[model samples]
Target: MSGGPGPGRWLTDRLSTLLVVRMALERTGAPRTAVAGALRWMSPAGWAAAAAGLPATVAGRHLGWAELVVAGAALLAVLAAALVFTVGRQPYGVDLRLSSARVVVGERAVGAVVVRNTAARPVLPARVELPVGTAEVAFPLPGLPRGGEHEEVFAIPTARRAVIPVGPVRSVRGDPLGLVRRAVSWTQVHELYVHPRTVGLASGAAGLLHDLEGRPSSDITASDLSFHALREYIAGDDRRHVHWRSSARTGTLMVRQFEETRRSQVVVALSRHEADYGDPAELELAVSAAASLGLESFLEEKDLTALTTHEVLPAVSRGALLDALTRLETAGGPRGFVAMARAVSRDLPHASLVVLVCGSGVPVRDLRAAGAVLPAGLRAVAVRAHVQDEGVASVGGLTVVTVAELDRLPRLLRRAVR
Candidate 1:
């Protein structure tokens, strides 16, 4: 009286079978989707032919129709022939190597793909496809005998700063009718970082001070090297810091107080909001300017923290900083300079100098608000990227400078700091 299996039970059984098949495939050095992807090898035309011809052939035989059967048989035969094109085994060993993984914008990125035949027999001519960023490139690979190889060298033009994905070399086989198609990936994807072009800035530019002993602040501490004053010793005060001579003179326990000294740290925050810039090129200029500042700070042996709209970038080394910058993109939302400044103030409260890099579209009011959020006694400077000659001005205690090119950054920064 029970049905063969309930719908839920049938689905569960099918899922269990799929999981077992996936595990088996994975254990054999094949991906779990190998079978599923194989099923999708049929092109749209092949699917359409199968969908119509199979039904037509079955119904034609049942209804005793000669023309329908003939048409269906011909369609099925075409599909079968197309399937033969994808039946052969592909014995390919692919190696994708790049000349360099990092380069400045407008430089050429070179790479080569080498394909070798691993099987004892010869490999038929085929097409190799490589996906670079959003585009796919194809190279014709000639037939190769056993132990034979072929190499294809390519160059990628880097017109703008970005992190471009290079490839996963894949071999594609398809029938001329576009009925059946098969692709097998042979190499993993690689990243090419087109870094922003940064100009050389003089050491200690932007008034960045380098001091191993640290700069003195207004905050008073009981255990620092910079002496500030002496106060009556509290019960919890360290006895080592107590001035015994002064205590004897005043007939009371006196402890020495010192001004807190912090190592010079520069925080460079580049705005990544799309609306903050008048044009796309402005943002690029701003990025280059920020990179210059960060590099200069590193060269001068100072602590540096680089930031953008949403996240903090690694500033441990110049290469790491530039790599992070290459991957940066503008935010679609309203997040801008003000948000980055607030982050610097909150997360990097001890920063001595805060450089806000943005485009000319940012309003003066926003710059003032950004400077206002920073901690007191911190030097705040804003660089507004533009397409015209550079200029400098002061707005609401914030030093605002407009830079049109990378070479003008140093002069603009010098003027702002002075």
Candidate 2:
């Protein structure tokens, strides 16, 4: 029993082995760093002296001066390396905030990142990286005392309509003299919506409503808002709508005839293919035009569906329309814009009005073909956004409007068929 290993000794041995193993792994992972730091701390000259004095120390000469120095240096390096790798927390945490979730192109939006050092102990300075779309911004953070905080403001670019990914701030820490480095992510990613710039216009310009009452139908109904003509009152005719003066003058029971008023639907089909707009400006204008029409449709509280090259977005609310517009990219897949437009138009034959916004690069013949595919009695309008200014015209049974600039979208949209 006396010769056997004690429980305390066994536990100490296990802990020591684990510590050694962990240190070894860290050193191996940072070989260049460890070597560089060791060189700076203990020079080649010092190493040579340590090696030279090793045999003398073994012989019990001069009380092992060089050996003691080398051991102390090695222990210092191990402790430093361990500390460098294990401090994973930053003094401050970051909260990302944007002034507005939705903004128009060419408009400025401000964002603030609130960094707070809520730790109980003073923390070392660190570096933070914030991702903005394709760009990365680096911030050199200053060391903060306990419970200290700072706020930083940044500008978000709205040159184009898009949903930009903003954050997931990352903190980086490292030794001063090429020793060790570590990185940790602090926040979640956020999206900033940049909506297309548009102009205010009447819903009638989009052909959604022919008149105040609505689109008229050939089918006659017993009772309706739109007046058609006066006729002799039948047995089932409601007396409330009887034309009393006309009945007295004619000595007969007469009732006002009315046509059926149908609620109109406006569908905006926009070409999202890059090929459709060879010029970037044209594409931007096209987006602006579509956005304007969609806005009008929403403002008027009419049934509206915004269509891209291949997808359909129902503009149920202003937020939903803007969200879809923000996320719509230039490329719309392989089916191509013309074909997709025709297919969509054909499927929505019942729609009262359909508006197509495309880049200038699209051919007039193709636009005509797209219009021809629409269901009978459905009206269609085409808007071509381009750099070369052109007047409005009608080709192949569809009215085409030309928009040279985004600012003139309202004026040009007024010329559209009602």
Candidate 3:
């Protein structure tokens, strides 16, 4: 440092170099970013052609070879032509509408896409892409004049229950060789719910002592619908509940002492762990069974709580319940149904009845364990979704049934209750 320059001079020199580099980058930053974006649009073949053509063109001019120059020039011309297809900005207005946002598993999800030209001039024909779940469907859109509209109706296949994403409809522009491509999305994504099939249950199929008035519990209350024993009137007791006949007989003011009445609240827990099902289709059967039970409770205006092994589903309304079921997915690993039952017992201590939905492959020991974890005296039913062996049996303080079909669910429940 002493031979070349002082320490201060060396520091100044380093600062000057950094400043020069920063100025250079600031001047070229936009152009570099633009070039990088353009490179992203180039396909593999286009990149290869450019890679070879640039070198060949420079070598040909230095070596005085005309053939090399002509070959490189032709290759570059093809690229330039492909680039023309992607040069313009897309001028389009699109609206995606679904015939019905929700449908059953076997039903079709019908939708229509209306596209209009928003520019003053005619727009060229393009390919429109619609992403449906993991797959994409393409439609050929004809050229439209200014202010013209085009409508295309399509149906999505719904072979099973699921929430399928059906859009973010995008228009694609590319050359025949696919050297350069551009796409612009026109609409937001929409969800199509394919709900599980459900079967109606008998009025008294499931719940705790099904009574239209209300089921009576051990806890006594001052005023309720169900009639209980009368007690000496408390200081704050309402005068309307004064039992005149009881008071006259007992020679004292006695108010109606009533048991706490509560409406039937049902809890349905569907086991989604992979180990519970021998075949993947068995999980579907389990879901249908659970859905049927929950939907029945929902339609009857019974308080319902539906859950899977991993998460809880909406049970507020019929549509919300079905929509949540459509989005349910199975989990992997060695988890058992006992966790779900324990959760029901913990979270919904006042639940009147608990329905355990599981596949046939679930061990009987696990089912017994699941029932054991519930609160004492809580009514429990285990619905084992079986492929063929369908019947009803009794476990320790728990009723167990095997259902082979959705139509058999109501009958199975009736049998379990009996």
Candidate 4:
């Protein structure tokens, strides 16, 4: 046997023994009811006297009434002190504050939790637990002064894009004797929304034709003049193109051939309608195609605008247009493709390209009705599955591109514009 116990070993052993005794008492019928009955049967002094008399009875030794009275008084004093400490020593309040209630993806977010001592006396908190997403963290508060606050910062991880929910913090206070612990829960909730990541594409889509052009070929034609490039004049070239300034410096003539700038303007219409399970994939493909076309046009420096039935209209700029598309990914509502197209045609310039990205379930009559209102030169391309009968033959002098044949959109667009 060991001659002496290690630090805190004696205290630990005492607590273990007390727990076992408490559990044993509890298992014998209803311990709480029994304790209540015991308390009712005798006064504190009478209970103390009974406890003091038990030792002598077990030892079969004679004990005087005066000695028993003194022993009982001493035991009562200790019990009274324990009752006071158990009730008045524990601390019981917690508060949490986040630097920002909302956060974006890939951003560093921080929060602080404050533990307060509501009791009049000091308390040693065993542990405080905070819930974050699918995990939980526990922190220790060795000692907290009465009416004082302890603050700690917690870091939020940025591994994925999503909405994260934080907390209903919990605090646990253990008895000084380490035999009993009390737990309390707090109500606090925080929300964070993570945005999507975007990568820029270097290739331009200016040369690619859009179905909204209402033309038949992908070749570039010389109808409109937009500045293309300046090059050195070659042999057999017209001398009228010679630049006197350039001849004076390098003795070379620089001629400018303005590249034909197409008059085609593109309008991308995104339907905000909710699709059924069978058509969700098709709908997503349509949306991606529309976004790709819009981005390509913007990069090529083509005039383009995007509209959604869900209250988003991005200017012709690439960034603003992309942001609109990103929002369209989670949009919900009824199909406003026909109505949106009619509005765009009426408000925008004539001969513009109207590209409608819609689900397969739109009524063909609505498409035909919209087609009648569009300008003579304006072209439309409706994207949907072939299964859903969109009875639309031609809308606003535009052509419909079935879901199965969507791959030919680039070529179709070039022809439409020509």
Best by TM-score: 3
Candidate 3, 150: how far from true, in Å?
1.6
TM-score of each: 0.79, 0.70, 0.89, 0.41
lDDT scores for all predictions? 0.87, 0.75, 0.84, 0.59
Top lDDT model: 1
Say what the RMSD of model 3 is: 2.9
What's the residue-level lDDT of 375 in candidate 2?
70
Q: How many residue pairs clash in each candidate?
A: 0, 0, 0, 15
Tens digits of per-residue lDDT, candidate 2, 338-383, equal 6766766667756777788888778878877876777766677788
Off by over 4 Å in 4: 1-264, 275-279, 316-319, 329-335, 385-396, 404-418
Candidate closer to the true structure by lDDT (higher is better), 2 or 4: 2
- Which of 2 and 3 is ahead in TM-score? 3
Write one digit per residue (lDDT tens) for candidate 4, span 347-375.
77553566676666667676677667676
Put down candidate 1 lDDT per residue, 1-418, tens digits, no spaces. 7568889999999999999998886797555466667669998899999998898899899999989999999899999888888887999999999999999998889999999999999988889999998998898889999999999999987999988898899998888898899999998899999999999878326364443337898998888889999999899999999899999999999999999988788888998889988898998999998998898888888889998888889999999999998888888887567878888889998887878899987888998898888888887888899987588898776888899988877777777667
